[model samples]
Target: MSHFTKCELKMTNLTALKRALEDMELDYTEAQANQSVQVRGWRGQTLDASMCINMGKYDIGVVSAGDGTYDLTADWWGVETTKGISEAEFKDRLSQRYAYHNVLQACEGKGYTVEEERNEEDGSIQLVVRKWVSD
Candidate 1:
């Protein structure tokens, strides 16, 4: 029997988060206003979350940490067995994707355009943003 666990992702941007989740091809429910989704846990356990990342026989959840950040909650053992992703690996993947989308969106909001997008040899991504200026 697996027990539920929670990890802080320190995520704040919802729009970027949505894109990140989608980019990973994950099935999830967005944060619903005034309502929380019930995330199924191990052995009939459950938790209510603002957003849900559904995995077969288990689920990961995003919840506000009461300090302007969000946490990722899950039955880590179950998820590892079902999805083959360890907790650290899951966090790293999601964090990387989230940062990628977040940076693009921030640059766009600041009137900058992406000039080059490149994936490096070290499993890292590089992005260049340029702003057009008129004298």
Candidate 2:
């Protein structure tokens, strides 16, 4: 319960995370304000999460790391055995989308317009942003 992997993910922006989850079309539930939900784990265990992604047998918990960041929590074994989705795969997918949303938000805040977005054959995303200049 509340097991966070040492992956290269440090979820800081809840807005970007929500956008990323929506981009991935995941079935998830966000807790109400000032409340947390239970995330099902292995061996009938559960952990509190601000948001939970349902994966049938097990759920991935999005919990606060208490360090101004959020980390993912779940029983990897149960999730993999039941859903056949590896931790690395989940991390990769979520990381990419999360970064995408984060980048877009940053660009927007800086008054940049996204000109083009393309997905490479190698599964990488390319984005082009522009800002108009006036004299």
Candidate 3:
């Protein structure tokens, strides 16, 4: 007989996510519960597991496991990909590389205008903003 336990993992809370983002330094604006925000990837980069996890706060279907090792498929925000880092380490690196200050600078450099800022139901502050690209 084979036994398997179906464990349901809860989604990370907004406050936790906000703190993680703060640690990483990624700039983000929050939307209402029913609103969807368009996530802009850094130039020349595509969405990966780390970014997905950071953005969505859940483990997406994409993951790699080998020899008792687990790695996220995405780069840690502005940090390049490297081995020998644990999941927690990776999260920390993401925060350092993509810190809010850095992200805000990048956005301003890109000419994006700040739209709005507000506090979430979780008592966390969120920025609602966007930028327009000239063709």
Candidate 4:
């Protein structure tokens, strides 16, 4: 009996998500059949996921809950593979990269140029963008 935990994300951008994952050098596969993953659970806990990220012995899944959002799902017991990565850490890194790419894309779309970019000591990214307005 295994249980998959679900962490709901703020938005759904499969393309951006994939790019973010690649930027982090994580191995993943994009779902094309629009199918969902079914898994068992402890105490009747179940999960239906839309996408999956290969993590060797285990996998992290993303479930689309409609309304422009998604949820990250994975079994807690199988989270750590030979790589010794945790589910929370994986989600955190993914979310960070996702946010980075999301902001980057938004800035580029609004005619803004990235002036400075750096990783802070707090494990967060700092970006400086600028857009000049002609009068």
Candidate 5:
């Protein structure tokens, strides 16, 4: 049996989330407010999802689990997309972009400027920011 797992996000900014998706070059659809999606689970069970990302043969769903939290709903059993990316890979990529977007915003809010940005060969990102400290 399969069911939607709660991811528990601290923040719920659809705009930021979409921006992360765009940064990752992943195609997604912004569903109408309160719209629900049907996600296929491991056991071929259908679950409710609120967001959909086009992953060729199989798509992943970002579902709202309430309290400003979202869940990644999908079938882990025998799931294969054209990209041949696993669920963990997809989530990691998305989280990285998401963190990047949030960190940039946070640093700017704290009067910090981005000094350098580097993309690691291992698909990781490195960002350096500087802020003027009053003496």
Candidate 6:
């Protein structure tokens, strides 16, 4: 029997996202972040998946786990917001919006039930997406 694993969709900004990807040394390129691309795990991995950036905000960015997912951001044209928005508030709002849209679209595509759980204190959201696969 094969066990199924769940993937977590953590929301962040573009600069941070880039930094994290670079730090992990994940093989990727800057293609609008929202553009669809097939993501194959490195080093003989079996998980072949696709992803795109669903949103980006200031130094933060959000991505969809699909090829045509939106690479949307709250940043002002690839630049951080200068509208006198605090760093903490900026990150929180951007992350929440990204989470909302990301899960909404993902679940809609899957045609499955989705339950949203929000963390107001941290300004984050999670979607309990129902996915079933048989081995």
> lDDT of candidate 1 vs native?
0.89
Query: For residues 26-80, what per-residue lDDT tens digits would candidate 2 score against the true structure?
Result: 8899999999999988778888899998989899989888898998888888888
Show how many residue pairs clash in every candidate, following the order shown: 0, 0, 10, 0, 0, 18
Q: Give the Å shift of residue 83 in candidate 3.
A: 16
TM-score ranking from best to worst? 1, 2, 4, 5, 6, 3
What's the TM for model 4? Answer: 0.79
lDDT of 3 by residue, 28-82 (tens): 5554455433332345334322223333332211122424322334333333222
Model 2 pairs in collision:
none
lDDT of 1 by residue, 17-122 (tens): 8899899999998665788898888888988888999888899989889888889999988899999999999999999999998899999999999999899999
- Give the worst 10-residue stretch by lDDT in candidate 3: 1-10
Q: Pick by TM-score: which candidate is best? A: 1
Model 1, C-alpha of 66: deviation from truth (Å): 1.5
Q: Candidate 3: lDDT of 127?
A: 68
**Range of the 10 consecutive residues with the lowest summed lDDT in candidate 6:** 40-49
Per-candidate TM-scores read 0.95, 0.90, 0.28, 0.79, 0.71, 0.30
- Candidate 4 residues lying further than 4 Å off, grouped into runs, are 33-48
Note the Cα lDDT for every prediction shown.
0.89, 0.88, 0.41, 0.74, 0.70, 0.41
lDDT (Cα, tens digit) per residue for candidate 4, span 51-103: 67766566677778777787777775676644587767777888899989999
Candidate number with greatest lDDT: 1
User: Which pairs clash in model 4?
Assistant: none
lDDT of 5 at 72: 67
- Candidate 2 lDDT trough over 10 residues, lowest sum: 1-10
Point out where model 1 deviates above 4 Å. Answer: none
Number of the candidate with higher TM-score, 3 or 4: 4
Q: What is the lDDT of residue 102 in candidate 5?
A: 82
lDDT of 5 by residue, 95-134 (tens): 8778889888888889999999999898788989999898
